[model samples]
Target: MISPTTIDQVFETARVEEVIGDFVQLKKAGSNFKGLSPFSDERSPSFMVSPVKQIWKDFSSGKGGNVVAFLMEHEHFTYPEAIKYLAKKYNIEVEETEQTNEQKEQQDERESLYLVSEFANSYFQKILHKTDQGKAIGLSYFKERGFTEDTIKKFDLGYSLDEWQAFTDEALKQGYKLEFLEKTGLTIVKEDKRFDRFKGRVMFPIKSMSGRVLGFGGRILINDKKAAKYVNSPESDIYHKSKVLYGIYHAKQSIAKEDNCYLVEGYTDVIQFHQTGIKNVVSSSGTALTPEQIRLINRLTKNITVLFDGDAAGMRASLRGIDLILEQGMNVKVCTFPEGEDPDSFAKQNTLEELSVYLIENAKDFIQFKASVLYEESKNDPIKKAETIRDIVNSISKIPDRIKKEIYIQECSKIMDISEEVLFSTLAQINKKDFKEADKQYKTEQRAFEVIKQQPVKKVDVQYVLERKIIEVLLLYGNRTEGFEDLILKENDKGQLILEPVINRAKVFEKIFLDLQDDEMEFTNPKFKTLYYTIIDTLNQNPEFQLKNFINSVDTDMANEITTILMEDERYALDDWERMHIFPKEKTQNVAQLVTETILSLRCFLIDQKVKEVQQKTIENKNNVNKSVLEEVKDYSGLKMLLSRKLNRAL
Candidate 1:
């Protein structure tokens, strides 16, 4: 647990844009920064970060919150992990809330896996630097590959001892559970026996986007005929190889700054490129291309350059990955090294300038690369040439943008000596059957492009809306002292109960609290009700209260609700709201009227709800209806009518 003071300081110092900008590419949109939703794959920007309000909202995924919440949601971090991450980023010393031994033991499984992996990473580094065998074998292997000491330490390269039980015995002796160590795949425990999983191997720590070590990739130094050369941590709670990109933790900033990601196949390829002063490179970490991996890069940039070793046969097979990139609507360029040179060997052989110059001079667009390779393979055979054209056209069809597709098709026609009409026809045929499965799934359903056609619209919850408005007013202007027309239930000359306006000067929160107390009413929605209590209680205690403490102390999910209430106007224009045929009642310039109208609307809605409830029971009754129920409905209806009249609206 983190102490309250430190948590408050984190929320105060961590700017929402600065934090989210590390993950999502945000551009200025009015007072807010907007970008594509990292939670969803969309072409347009709907994710918004508000620096002024210090919150973010992914409208596509409905995930909205403050900075800490963003980390917890995006990176799947625990609350403490998120706080500590922010504390480290901003140089704030975290004041921790002490936990009992039992509380510490009760930590969740995923966090335990993370902790074990962290321990393994730190232990590996210790062995690589401290032990004679590690410095001689693992350090020697990395040094032989031309990696400098700084580069080796930056990537946290390390070596596990050659002995089978070396790491397992050490971990157990350190009080780590065998279950977690085994589950994290750092140790293999079976049949009352345990051993190191990465025995006698150089360590490659696989990390999440936020830099936490998730798993490890290990390489054996002495290649035995029967033994495998490389081994990676099996899929655990934290490590999903398909979704993890090696070096993304270090490459994210450079990728965003350069607006390009250099993708390679192996860990060495990524490291070699980074060593050459090209920092925006990541590897698929030996896995085949995946949409999930591409989307990770997509969050940072829309451009990728696939760098392949000089193996032409390998490049031909790897060309399939370019289609996946094209499907993601990315601008892709492909570059291969000179024959007999991989990224690792080529990078080690050349200076940074040489590697940089070679890439710029040789990089080709996806269409050109695909066409050149396939065309060369086609030779003088007519049938082979025709198949090559179709293959190139298929790649073009993968592009989602029509304009880009046409441009690629035109380029293909010029390269293949084919007509644009022929290429277009081929593309249309390829794309026509692309959605066949989706069409079958949605045959009876409404088309997605058409938002609502025959589907029924959900009825608005009147009371819920009113409750939100009440919360919104309190969040915006709760402490402001204003003259209010306090409606008092009084009897006129005829002795019948009627409402009269009694003038009073009071804080807005005090007025709303008193009225709700007088009516013995509470918010009908749980989310809104909890928020109302928090805001009212805080404002009542200190009339000069600022929103920083309130927003900071609230639960993360509640922060979304708070932003939804506080930043409603950021989403819509009040000036043009009437054009949509909905009149704006609350959030007016006059704070008193905004507060008064919201409370009145809520009262009217609650009264209406009560009358409906009474009427429902009256209809369900088989015996004579209770006289009290009928009077209750009539009296609530009369009060609703009076409140409606005061609001100058008809019920």
Candidate 2:
């Protein structure tokens, strides 16, 4: 029940680029920004943002919208959640009006989970700073790890007490429902008893791309051998651990700025790097990196620098993630720390400048990293070495970029002491196998869909004709002097009267639409009724309704439709090209220019026809009309006279 005024404030202050750039890395493309499409798999960027219009369009997926619309599309955020997120970002105060119980019940489940998670975040943070147990345990743990007060607070780090019901009791005291607490994995319920799940653990809160708290990761301080060293909140409506990357919310801006992200293994590693001023860092929290997580980082930066411990097992686990990153078309570099150290310890041992230098000097491309590591594992047996080279080439072939693949192939051949042609042949074989399997899967899905009687998808970008007609009318009549047109009807003697055109744009549209009613003129695609009404209503509201604003405001389907039409009929580029060629025509420059004059004359003829209408109307309304109408008539007459002079000169 947020007030309309509060909602409007959130919407008005929420910049589309700021919101989208959190999840997608955008670089300047002409007047707009472009990034890889979040909705599909691709190597090249197809997402576009226009700051002038405050809208974004994903050309690959055909989705476009304002900030709110993007949240809805990408995160499946409800309208209220999207607004509240923007409010939190921009620091706008939300004023909610009271809602009835039934009305409150109608709120979406995911939104409630978000609210519960947010409440849990505040609860954990409060425990860390305010409660004795939290202060002694979580705060002490982070401090012992060499985290400064500002660093801890900046990341919203917190602690949960060792008491069984400490967090659950406080959450319940604050009127948070046990059901939702359990749903968000903040509380564990067993056989009619409930308790805090993160007791005795130092808290590391996980955040959404927009920086909203979604869940937490916690580490144990006790020496219980039976207990896991670290535990994280289970998957919930708001948090999907496999799909989440810790510190991404905090590091997105820096990652985008640097055009790279530094991947680490744990929460402390991320914090230590940030403390050292290497800000573009995130962690998978020691789990196997999923494609979903890789895609999330891919949205922020194409290049990833994986900093893993130099242990053998660590290198093997990381190699698996490397292939996943390559499959997503991301550029990956590996930076292994010393055998005895992790990122947290290593970063703590060095200053920011030293760490930066170490990273720069040690980083290796994926192929080299893979070949070097696997070659060591293979112990230089020529047969095993050859197999290792093929394995490395397989990873290289997964990369979608042709240039990158070629470069890696050359590097791999040199490293393995093999022929480049042989490696290329191996890569080609792997690529063919991958594509055949992919095509087979696609055909299987198509067959299944056919059995379900699903209709085949019609071709995309095929309905330019209808869109062109709409644009044609808008350009011709947007600001014209418009009035209602009268049509003839049968009289008593079966006589008829003439029809007249309308001066009002809305009325002209209405007349045109009515005339086309029996013709059943189709727009060639289905649209939501509300969106259709919105477009029509906007055109009806403004006498000078520019097609650009309306077109930009709608979804991608309509915007693409309008842009295609506007660009299709206008040969402005060629027109200028021909105009510039005037003197090059040998001794026939006059004839070349005369043809251009003919088109200009026809344009004037159309304008003069409208000018005569206004002039006739001016005479009829001489005594009753406003003075502005007379001025408009004079302007039109002068324009017509100028055109007439041009016509005479050309003749």
Candidate 3:
């Protein structure tokens, strides 16, 4: 129900790069910016952002759109949410039409879940700051862990009351359904009894990349023998713990600014580091690191440093994560704390500078860290040592950049006391094995898809010719006041002013556009009805609509289509062509240019003929020498002169 004026503001203010840059780290690549694909696992960057066009396109994923579309695709935001987010970011006032109950009922389940989760986040946060149970339990726990009031508020940390159904009572009173509460695992329903799921536990709300709260992780206060220490929201439409990392919402900016992400294993680890002035840190929250999570981090920064407790098991568990990070085309380094120390304890015990210095001095490359950790475990046994070396090399092979792979291989050989050639040989074998398997998988999927390659639309013949002529006229002279003669047509021996079958180029476009609204049509095909509509819309909007603007608005998928329609039937080098008759020099260029212009101009005239003929034929068939049809031809004749002027600009 957003107003058209507000929607226009959102579109105007939401710069595509500014919005998408929040989730993807963009680096300048020629005229465009390129980044790793957020939707896929790719080493080379295939995601492109065009600031001039106000759109982003991911070649790897085949998704492309303007700023709102990017938000819809990347963060999975609803159209209204995306518009509201842009408005907030750009500080624009939003005016919305009132929604009825039926309109509210039309919201999808996924949207409903997002709304419920967002409401819960606000509810929990209010309790933490306002209620006695929250202040006494959650605030105390965070304070005891060395978090300041500012840090606590920044993260929106909160708690659920000890009494069962406390949150449920408030939610239900607010008209939130118990079913959604149970579905989101906010209120556990057992034996037909519903109660607040996180009763008495401090809250940790997990947020999506765009900062909407998707779920929660809560910790209990008492050391109850029967109760689990921590509980997280169950998997739902909006929340997937395995695919999300804690503190990402807060740390994404810092990570991008610093160009490195500090990866930890607990919520406390994130708080302690941020409290100590290191803001580019996030936690796995004790879940095993996943490629999806790593790719999420990869989208923000290419460098990741894993921080682990000094325990042997913790360090070993971190090794697997390191390999996955490498597989994601990221430069990874590992930093383990002093024995018995973790990020939380270590940061609390030391100054920010001291902690940072320790991390920097102790950080080791993935291969060195792996070799050092496993070398002792293997205990100089030849087979065990060889297996360890191969394992490290296999991880190295995962790196997509050849130069980086070579450097790591060289470093690994030096650290493991093995020959460089041996590691290189091992890496090649592993890479070949992986490549073959991937190729086979891709071919299998492609074969399945090949079963139904969609058929192409039939080429537009006369209608296309006519439409392009009108579009060209509208593009160049829609608002211009040019003198016109009122041509008359004789109908039943009576003479009257003529109007074309579809006169007023803008009106003609709108009528034809409304007539063709198929969703399955590919806009790339020049014959596509959708393509004609798209072009017509652009032509009708701007009084000064030019060919360049039309070309700029389209994505690569439609770029050729627009370009072909504009240039193939429109002259660009008429002046140069004229030069050929007068000049001794520039024969090749002038002749070629003349040939091109002749072809283009003839095409335009032919299209105009088709438009006139179609209008004339329709009038003749009706046996009414239509007066409107004569006026249409007169208006079109005036447009033809303007179009010729546009084409002969150089003259």
Candidate 4:
């Protein structure tokens, strides 16, 4: 547990952008910072962070939260751990209280994983420096690759001994837990057997932004054709390869300072570039460029100069990467090394100044470079030439900025000797077809929960729909304090009792809770019932409700459920609402009315359901129709009519 004062101090000190920027790459999008989602693999940035509100929302994953929540979700930190992390980040002293057993367990598990990883890193480093095999094989191999001792130590490079159980046995003898070692992928355990996962390999420690060792990437030294050349840490609580960049930990500052990032394809490319005093560089670790990796660079810089190996396959890979970058609306320039040279080898051969000049001279805009290379290959065949033109046009269409797209189109027309109008037509068709496909996918996805519209009345499951509506209302408006009109009996001028409207102040949750209790109504669905009470309890406890904080605090499933309900009504909401001269009324404008109407509709539904039940009972006892059953049907019918009238609906 953490003291409230420390929590408040942490919140006040930690900037949301500064904290989240350490993880996901964020670029300014209007008033908010938008980037690729760390929670999911996405090309376009669906993850948004609002500096003003100090909150973040990942539309792709339906996760939203305050800064603390972001840490909790992204780092898998416990609430107290997240608070402490921020406190440490901001240099705030923490005042603690005793934590529950659950917190202790969670904290212990995650901390151990990190501890074991760091220990493994140190142990491997010791072997590299102290042992005979480490020196003769690993040290010599690095020297041959042109890496100096200082460079080797700076990057925390290490060597794993050839024997399988040597590393595992040493780890356990040091009092480290085998569970954590296996969890961090330093060791593999199966059916009471344990062995080092990276035996006889050179180890590369993968680190988080703040420089904590998360996992490792190891390269095999021996000439065993059966084994993979490189093996990465498997996905675990601490490490996700897709969400990490190879040299981000080292290059973040330089990338931000230079306002440009040099992207390469291998670890050596990144290390060699840094050794040459060119620090704004990272690698995809032999994996194809991912949106997550691109956004990691996007956080520090918008401009990416992709350094491609001078080979046929590298050119093809470059083409694929360019399209993904364009889709992210980034300024991308492609630079290929001379024939038979790669970024690693090229950097080793040239001085920093020489390499920098070469990059500047050789760099070309994606459109021009793509057109020139793609055209040369297809110029002989007219049919292939036509396909190449479309391919270039397709990449241009990926640019999110209309101006950029148009400029690229004009450039393409000149290079291809085609008219701008024809190019524009091709771009429009590609965009329209893409739009239709997206729309169709969206419509298909919407079928699971579309408000029960277009269904027969008898098949509608009206009770379930009404129950969902109640939960939605509570989640959206529960904390809103408003003046609600209540009818009270009053003596008029004639001294006769009469119904008069009275204004009373109450929270929306209070009104709904009281009304539901008054009628002994409850949600039928087990999930909805639990969720309803959770929302009501949460709202009741906090008079000033913070939706993002609440969403971040709850479990993932609950947060997702709440977000789904909140986002559903806005499913049809057009972003061009003002441009289209259309505006929908805000639910906030009438919180009291919305609550009243939702409750009234629920009562009416329940009453109608009761009436049908009674009528069914009467039919079952047709020979001697129960008098009480007839009155029951009549009473339910009259209640339904009255409720419908109150709702301004025909009975």
Candidate 5:
């Protein structure tokens, strides 16, 4: 358990810009820093880091938080992990108290899997370096493949001993549980006996983007005909292969720095590329590419250059991945090495400069790559050529950006010697078919939700607007002192009613709270009601409450809402209105008026609702014409008139 003092120290010392800059590239934008959102694919900057507020907001994804929250959200770190990461970053020594037995026992299941995976990774690395068999076999294989000792260590390459029970026995002896070992696929338990899963294989530790070991991939070096050449960890609580990319932990920063990624098909391809000084590279780890994998890269950069071996299988894999990349709206380029060499062997055969030069010269846009590869296969067969042209058009249709699709379509038409009009017609037909299929599926699903159609959604317009405005005011200027004016009804000496004005000064939150209390008003929106009370409670406890401090204490949804409200203008600050000599007024400048108007508007809206309800009741029971019902309707109508008069609105 980390002490409160350490957490507070971490929060105090960590600067939002400095912390986020480690993951994102931030350029100065007025009082804040702006960059492309790390949470979404965007060509323009929408992520903002405010040093003053000590918070960051990615407008693209509607995610925002303080430094600790950002780490937790972006890196998927647990609370303790986020704190520890910050502490390590800022060189702040963490102060901890020992967890009780109960606390230790209550640790989450996913975290236990992470612990076991980490232990397995370390254990395998130790064996690779410390044991005779590991050094002779695993180290020899890697070294023989032209992998440097530094590269081997950097990627945490290792070797599992050939003996069936070697890893299982060692893990059990070290107090690591067998259940987690089996869950992480490091140990295989069978019929009251246990054995290591990756026995006699060279280990490749797979890490999450934050550098935590998620699982492992192992390769068998022996030439046994029956045994599979490669094995990967099974899907587990902590590792989902489809959601993770190999070398992403090491490649993320470089990917962002270079504004492009070199995607390959295997672990060695990624490692070799990194060793050759092209750090922005990741592999699908030999799995067929998935939309989830493309989105992972999409978060860092919009550009991907896929490297393929100059073989039929490699070209097929490249073709399979390109459509998925385009579906995610990423710009993809393709580069194939010379015949008889993969990324691993090719990088080894050439110097770093030669390898870099070859990649630059060989890279082709996806449209061109598709046309050229498919054209060669089609030869002069007109029918086969037509099919190839349709295939290329289908890939172009997957792209969501209209301008990018148009440009690619033009290029494809020229390369395939097809008319531009014909390609456009084919694309429209494909899109129309897709839409019809989607609509049919949607209608089928809608039938299952027939109950929802029975009760139509009612619009709570006035209450929603008024409640949200109140919350925005409290979040923005709740602590500031402001002067407020109130209108009161008074009797003159002649017993005539006259309006009187009274003025007072108080904190904005206090003024608003008192006004609501005087009117006996409350927010009708449940979320708004909850936020209102929370803000009031927080301000009562700490008069100096800040937005960042409040945000840090709330749950993610509430924090995002607060950030969205606060950053609404900053999102459009790129317009630079001040430079045009058209300075916008700050909300705080008229805080008291805004607060008073919001409360009065809510009150008037409520009275209007009451008037309508009473009138409906009167109509429903008009045959009886009860005096009490008439009086109720009259009273509500009069109240609405009085409130409307106070608001200076026409009745």
Candidate 6:
């Protein structure tokens, strides 16, 4: 468990903008920061960060919270993991109480896998720098490849020893369960024996975007004809190769800053580029590019520059990737190095200045590169040329933006000596075919959804609105002091009863609590009831209660609810309603009135429910002609009328 002081310090030291900015590219919008929703695929900005409030809200997905809550929602982190992430980010010392043996044994499987991966990363690094055998082979190999000591350390490169049980024995002796080790694919267990998976290989720790060591990619040092050169960690609870990109953790900031990403292949390609002063680059770890990986890059920028090897095979291999990039609505450019060299070798051979200039001058837009490359193969055959033109037109049709598609069409027309009219007509046919297929899929899904909707569902709670309103008022204006007026029935000096209006100043929370108690009202929703009491307790315990602090103390679900309520109001504030001549009334001005009205409305609703119950009873007993039941129904109906009158509603 993390110490309360450390958690509080994390909340105080971490800024919402700075923390969220690491994941989403936020641009300044008035006093707050706005960005495309990281939680959804959006063109316009719906994710807003409020520095003043230390919270964020994704208007698209309706997920909102403070710094820790954002991490828990976005990164799928537990409470302590989120806190530790922030502590590491801000360089704050984390003070955690040691877990007991029972607590350690109860850790979840996924967290255990993560711990094993992290431990493996540390162990491999220790072997690389501290041991003689590691330095003689793994460290020397990196040095021979032109990797500097700083580059190797920055990327956390390491070497696994040659012995089969070298890693497995150490990990098992260190109290890591063999089950997690086998699950993470770090240890391969047979009938009765276990061995290290990446033995005698140089290790590259593959990290998630948040910089957690998800897994590793190891390159075998010794040259053997029968063995594969590189092997990667298998899919596990913490790592998915299809969904991860090598060096994304290191490249994300630069990708956002430069507003572009240089997509390469292999781990060394990414590291070499970063070492050569090109920091905004990531690799697919030698696997074919995937839509999941493309979306990962799409979260940061819409521009991707794919760096390909100069060989013909490399060029041909990358054509499908270009189409994939186009399909994601990204502006893709291709940069091929000199003949016989890849990004890793090319970067190692040239100075940063030369390589940088070459990339800028030689980079060609995807359409142009595709045309030029295909023209060479089709120059002799008219049939092949026509097919190439059709292929290019098909690629152009995949672009989502109409303006960009038109622009690409015009460029393709110029390059292929074809008319824009013909290209546009071809694009229209492709789009029509696409639309028909998409419409077919939509109908199929709609039919399924309609069938599901026919099933009976419990009716939504009608008291939800009033309950939510009560919570919202407390969250927004709970700490503000307001004057409340109440009617008191008192005995006068002449021994006659008289109603006197008394005014008193009290916090909004105090006023709402007293008003609800007077009517014996309670929240209907279980979650809302818990939240209401938690807020009241927080306000009572600390006179200077802050919503952000209160948010940090609650669990993830309740915190998200509180932030949603608090941010629902701020969403309109972001619209700057005052400038639009829409002067909204402040709730604080009539806190007492709002509280009384809300409580009265709830009472009226409850009375109406009771009257309906009695009316139902009277109907059920109608055949028997029960006089007492009819009289009870009449009394409940009259009570409902009085409650309605209190709310100024006509019965």
Best by lDDT: 6
Query: In order, how many clashes per candidate?
Result: 0, 5, 9, 0, 0, 0
Relative to the true structure, candidate 5 reaches a TM of: 0.84
lDDT per residue, candidate 2, 1-651, as tens digits? 688888778766878888898889887654467788889977677677766556677766767666777888887777677787789989999998665645544667776677677777777788899988888878888888999999999999888888899888877776667888899888999999988888888888898777777888888899999988898889887788888899988899999889999999899999999998999999998788999899888888889999989798778867888989988888899999888998999999999999999999999988778877888878658888878888898888888889989998888878888899998888888888988999999999999978877766667442343344444454334334344322223344446442332233334345444434543543444542343345556767876675545653566566555444433322222233344564223212233233324333444544566678877887897877788877876887666665555456532
The local distance difference test score of model 4 is: 0.82
TM-scores for candidates 1 onward, in order: 0.87, 0.74, 0.74, 0.68, 0.84, 0.88
Candidate 4: clashing pairs of residues? none
In TM-score terms, candidate 4 sits at 0.68
Evaluation by lDDT, superior candidate among 4 and 6: 6
Please list the residue runs of candidate 3 whose C-alpha ends up more than 4 Å from where it truly belongs after superposition.
Answer: 1-5, 95-106, 428-651
Error of 1 at 175 (Å): 0.9
Instruction: Kindly list the per-residue Cα lDDT of model 3 for residues 237-275, writing each as its tens digit.
Output: 888888999999889999999999999988989988999
Give the alpha carbon lDDT tens digit for every residue of 73-130 in model 1: 9888998889999999899998886766466458788887887888889999999999
Tell me the whole-model lDDT of each prediction, alpha carbons only: 0.86, 0.75, 0.75, 0.82, 0.86, 0.87
Per-residue lDDT tens digits of candidate 6, residues 1-651? 899899889998999999898888887765678877877876677888889778899999998989887887777777799999999999999998887756766888887887888899999999999999999999999999889999999999999999999999998778888999999999999999999999999999999889889999999988898878999999988889998999999999999999999999989899999999999999999889998898888878989999998888778877998888888888899998878899999999889999999999999988889888899999999999999999999999888899999999999999999999999999999999999999999999999999999999978676997899899988878998877766666999999976577989999899889878877887878999999999999899999898778787787788788778767766765566666888878766777888878877887788788778877776787777677877877887776765565556887
Question: At residue 309, what lDDT does model 3 achieve?
Answer: 82
Candidate 4 per-residue lDDT over residues 1-651, each given as its tens digit? 688888777877888898988766677654567777777745566777777556677777877767877887777766777888888878999998765545434657778788688888999899999999999988888889999999999999999999978888988887777888888888899998888999999988988765678889899998999999999999898887886878888998888778899989888889999998899898877777888777667756789998888797668766898899888778999898988999999999999999999999999998788887888889999999989999999999899899998999999999999999999999999999999999999898789547576665666887888788888878767777899877666999999976577889998889989999999998898978989988888887888787656665677667656666665554333143545777767777888887888788889878877878877877887898867877877788877766766677986
Q: How well does candidate 4 score on lDDT at residue 36? A: 70
- Model 3 residue 245 CA deviation (Å) reads 1.4
lDDT of 1: 0.86
